[model samples]
Target: MGTKIGVIGGSGVYEIDGLQDAAWVDIDSPFGAPSDQILTGRLGGVEMAFLPRHGRGHVHSPSTVPYRANIDALKRLGVTDVISVSACGSFREEMAPGDFVIVDQFIDRTFAREKSFFGTGLVAHVSVAHPTCPRLSQACLEAARAEGIKVHDGGTYLAMEGPQFSSMAESKLYRDAWGCDVIGMTNMPEAKLAREAELCYASVAMITDYDSWHPDHGAVDISDIIATLTGNADKARALVARLPALLGPERAPCPHGCDRALEHAILTAPEKRDPAMIEKLSAVAGRVLG
Candidate 1:
């Protein structure tokens, strides 16, 4: 596969200073319409696809962001790698607001969303023990650092089910007991589905506030987070520009096997698999479904 980079991020991250030939192109997926038209362009001579995670004006909430459609669309766009950038609340003081964390792990507490492309008719289990692609993440980390963004190379992200912010008790538990470094409302089904789609995935969590756990910072509030996102947005855009230069215009197979997750994961016999489900899996599991 070529080094076509797909970035699923908020509206502001896509408009870097020197993006060439940028255009938002619509993609209708079997899963559904993606969050918005994907902004397709070239940066650093690499093909880039940028989808606004929350739609153009930030319409969708966390649970309803159409995670499946977004990943499926990116896969269909011929994106060899997917990078997710989302606003998060910090659990650790050191991480702080405005820091960018290259999330290495996830504890997905989101239960209401469709977490995979395969289901009852077509079953598959892909390993997510080490979810994020290390090589891709290193590129992201390097990109952020080169832009003078405060980048933490690794951290554990706790993905919560929410349109609601975490309660104080929940925040404390995630911070003190679970050892979560940052908390976000998205990145759950998003990351999991990417693995099932066999796309190299990397998550960069931009801290917007301290989630209810900091006594000094107090509880995480949407207003503060929004204000923080203004700066985060600028930092994120700068970070995005640096990626294409670092990742280059061609790529090697993911050293971690993210590009071929379904080689042996599908346990359902081909004869037993539903034709309808197989048709829907054309873009995602095509390499194996054939």
Candidate 2:
């Protein structure tokens, strides 16, 4: 099978360009309804799928995104590579507003969302020691550079559960004490769920503000974030448009082991696994489960 790329658009980014035969297709996932109908088509002869993380018109909050269903829906659509483009607040001045960071690690502080596909009935544990897929992330970094976008090669993303921006104290702690590079509300369970689905996931964090830690910036202003997001969104689309050629229309097994994450990750013995849970996991874990 050829490579099928999936792009998850975040705040201020509702869609992408340069797709041929683009169509919004409704994909029903067993987990639940995805954030929105997926936009699928071909870009530079490579299959592509786009999903708005917040849905069209920005209907869902950060905490309300259907993380599990989103990953399942992409997996169901045969997306071999998943690219998440989200807006974030930077901790360092060098990673200023309008910059892009290819996040390679995550500190998941989100508590309310469903973070996994396996549970009581069936059990599995996938290694996330190095969260983002290196090969895919490198492709993102190169694409951004090719587009003349100031993009950092790697950084750690702190995923917080929020509809509200962080307090001064919280922002300072995450920036100084924890050494986080960029902070965002999405990407937690979304990245985790992608691993559980055995998909090669890469995160492209677009910097919008300096958070509340910067003395000059004071607090996160909606007006400021909106302005930066608007500019960053345009650059993000250009970077995405360059991906198909770099990644090519065909793919081999992931050299970093992203494609075979479930190889030795399942713990439940075949006989002991629940039939219902196994059925539910069919799409995400079918390779190892079968």
Query: TM-scores, in order shown?
Result: 0.97, 0.99
Off by over 4 Å in 1: 11-17
Whole-model lDDT, model 2: 0.94
lDDT of 1 by residue, 228-274 (tens): 88899888888888888888998988889999999999989888999
Candidate 2 clash pair list: none
Instruction: List ranges where model 2 is wrong by over 4 Å.
Output: none
Q: Tell me, by lDDT, which candidate is best.
A: 2
State each model's CA lDDT, in order: 0.89, 0.94
